[model samples]
Target: MGGFHRFYPNACDLRSLPVQEVDESVSVQEGQRLLQSGLLGGILLRVDDVYQVILSSDLAGEEGNQPLKTKAWRPALFIHARMPVAELLEQWMKTPDAVPVVADEHGVPQGVIDPLTSAGVLHHEFTRIRSYLDSILAQVNECICGIDDRHKVVIWNSKAEELYGYKAEEVLSKRIENFFSNLRITNCMHENKELKGHYHQPTEGTHVLISAAPVTHGSAVIGGISVEKDITEVVQLNQELTRASSQVKLLEQEIKKMSGQECAFRHLTGRSAVMQELIRFGKKVSTTDATVLLRGESGTGKELFARAIHQNSNRYMHPFIVVNCGAIPNNLFESELFGYEGGAFTGADRKGKPGMFELANEGTLFLDEVGEMPVEMQVKLLRVLQEGSFYRVGGSEPVQVNVRVLAATHRDLEAMISRRQFREDLYYRLNVVSLEIAPLRERREDIPELVHLFVQEFCQKYGKSITKIEPAVMTSFLDYSWPGNVRELKNAVERLVVLTEGETITEQSLPENLRRNTYISLVTTPAAQGNLMNVAVEAEKQLILKTLQQVKGNRSEAARVLGIPRSTLYYKLRQLGIPAKG
Candidate 1:
């Protein structure tokens, strides 16, 4: 009763069958009519709380006036309403009755169970299970092939069809060894052992990693099953990566050789006092794993400073990853910064991916245009900065990374904090050691050196031999306000080096804006109404001072700018009593 309790009152409902009740006096013809009306089995008689089962076959040959109880009928089998449906079926199967009466604990008739209804439920459940398994198998990328005891292929999935270039229909009944020579399916079956992680290249001309296991039935090996993964692209990528790594090593060696006599921060070239001070501070910070914030205008070489700091640090051998916060779409920002697990989204990689923080582990992560990062992301970033750990998108595990963060931005973060556009805690976290880069116009004294370096770089790149820059061109460069900073100067120098035809770049090679601005400055400034010699000398002194400022007190460049011999410029400086360095 305990086992049959769940099915008691409505055992017929378990198989979705209907119940038919009858009294002892009910005619056999009436029971036949009830069975024909769709009751698979009918109840014959009820005495004291027990109902007798009368099957359709028992009333088949009986006369119309004969009572059903007079024909063959089994003793009533009673079950409680709380009895299990499966346990009721088991007990019913042991009896001669085709149906079992269901009742509640109070002894009231509920329903009965019919065998036909039970079969329908099992069929539907098995079909659904088969469909679910088929869907999973069809979508899997690895090739799976199985053979039966006769060595004939019994299972060949879609991925197997794609990998071996054979349809499932062509291989279903075929012997696996006859079609695939390198599969070793026969050996696995005969030896009853597994072949794991074996690299194979079959005559069909495909690189695959194969693993095979013997299928067993009782104590005997029946056949074999094999899983194959295509790795041709992976192998090719590994070869290319090896070559790239070798080239990087050679480049590193060359850089080290060139930097043997110079400091690691030698690329930051300038004689300006502000430039020197920034360099000194950067060198000091690079020795430790400190979070640094670089504040500067666009194109002012903030990324360059970040790289210089990374290269001079103890973590130089590790990665220096740059994340452009502004370039990423807002919706994809979290996934891009923190990565995601497989199936995290529709287009995510199956094997999952490592995020920027994970990739920059034991290294440095430079967040360029950090101010453009969304407000919500700022809170997450602040937590990562404080905790040194973060969870991946759609993930639960916290990943720890020992990375030094360097953030750069052109926007005013202080104003952003007031507006609630940037997080205050994140601001303090990133600004642990803030450094500012002065704009090109503010440090005009660095232009001549910067120009020389850019020209030399581009000349070598373009296979040119240009070495000298015309003094008029230098004077014009110093006169203009460079709104685009050092990046703009580098581009202009590259253009001049590529287009100029002579060893010395002439003033005509300068951009039209620079030339026009110099001409306007000269024409607009009023001159004294006096002797021509006096006005010309005054103009010469002004030009000399501008040139000195441009070249950062480099006398040779100043003399060249004035179109006077170096000795003559020195003599005139002493005669005119103008400080030569200024």
Candidate 2:
């Protein structure tokens, strides 16, 4: 036991030299010493007058070994120690709701690393971290919170409570949907897979930011961890930062998504017009023998669309194979895509296994990032298309494929053709039926619907309810440009869902990046003149109106503040559609 640590054995011992008694509970410190001792057989101590001791399986298994009693999780007692080990074991025995701990090689019992301690050290650490976070949040002056696995409100920070008119205690055990009013919070979470900088909640006029990570145990997911912050005011001050982050990244990840080659279109999420259109097109082209091409931005669900196309085609009943032509190393492209016969290569498969084409006969074959295919492979593919045949290395038999082809890529084939990097002839062949997917920003109207689907999905996934969004949130969602496209939007929506403390989402639930500042475009040309003037007047009018409202409709005071006559102030207010407060 001492081998794992630096502790050395004492020169002299008080009790019996080596071996002794049976089952009994001993004091904790004393039992530790006995286990630390070099020589010992069995020890015992009476715990609450009940004698019990744990026996080593090694000794018990021996033909003439001693038999001893044992408990599953609790430490065993050795009867040979000077003091009864039973007394030590009894100290922690029958303790209600104790967490299990594994013993190290040296018999050191411990659980997670400093996570559950309530000692001052842990308390201080948590406090320091919280304080630093709070300071940063305060500098931005935002409201933030997060949720647990069941979607319960685990982190209703002071600011959140202050803005929502609820105490942390009142909101702690409840799920976010229980108190929220907007439905968009769930939607935003679904889009981004993370809540960006600041977001709004279901509570009107309040905004927040939320982030989360999942916690897993074995094959099951125990729960998740999340963080939140409110930055409505701060974002308004610096609207240039409206781009928020994704929730998937914010939350702790138990499993990695790996890469596209490792996944058959995993990480894809969509159910909008863009998604439906691709499916409809796939169905149309898949039934026929025509080759299909899927074009979209990177991470815009192209591979997923390709896989779906193959699955629904006439080849659905057969082996639907996928090949990432771009991912195959240039040197190994031929061997990997076109398998070798026995002795074809230095270390070819002795059985002469067929290439992807042979395996995909009478089925659907998907080519991802086909633009990345080497020119040599392009000619080979052209041969297969022109004549339903290809030769396996060292084999004379030409393999015929009744296979349908579906190819997808993020690159512009026309641009690649201009560069002469991709084969124009092959592009024309594959482009018999092309499906172009619109980016997320192009179809902003579909966002609301898409967000809802994700929220509902995540609710069932995390065993949580769908929280809502604030009214002001959509203004930002619509205003911000999603460069990462629908995929990024989906991630944000998921983040918002986990961060919420209520059912309704609000502007407060929208991420900071979603509510970024409006850039002042300088357009001096006559065509853009009207646009710039209108924007300016609108801003000035709103500024005056907001200032007037702040003073509670004091027209005289507003006029004085604006350095204008009361009549002029009233006229301008009427023109801007700003109503007077009673």
Worst 10 residues of 1 by lDDT: 1-10
- Residue 143 in candidate 1, Cα distance off native in Å: 47
Tens digits of lDDT, candidate 2, 1-582: 224432222111112223333343333434444544645433433354443333232233333222223331324322222222223224325542232222334633222111133233334545776777567545543345555556676666666666668988898878877887553434443443434443445556555566544445444554444455665577665554433333444331212222222232223344456665655555566557788888888756776677656554445557878898878899777767667789887877788877787788888778888889988789888888878888888888777777788888888789988998888889888898898977777766555555666778777876777544443343345445778876787788788777777666655666666655322221332333567567556555645754465345788865654445779778877887777656
lDDT of 1 at 71: 74
Name the regions of candidate 1 deviating beyond 4 angstroms: 1-262, 526-540, 546-582
Model 2 lDDT vs. the true structure? 0.58
TM-score of each: 0.53, 0.43
Off by over 4 Å in 2: 1-282, 501-511, 517-582
Q: What is the per-residue lDDT of model 1 for residues 52-164, given as tens digits with 9 covering 90 to 100?
A: 77767667767667767777457767777666556676687788544566676796666655557766765665587678658866988888888988889998999988877
Error of 2 at 170 (Å): 72
- List per-prediction Cα lDDT, in the order shown: 0.79, 0.58
| Cα-based lDDT at residue 292, candidate 2 | 83
Which candidate comes out best when scored by lDDT?
1
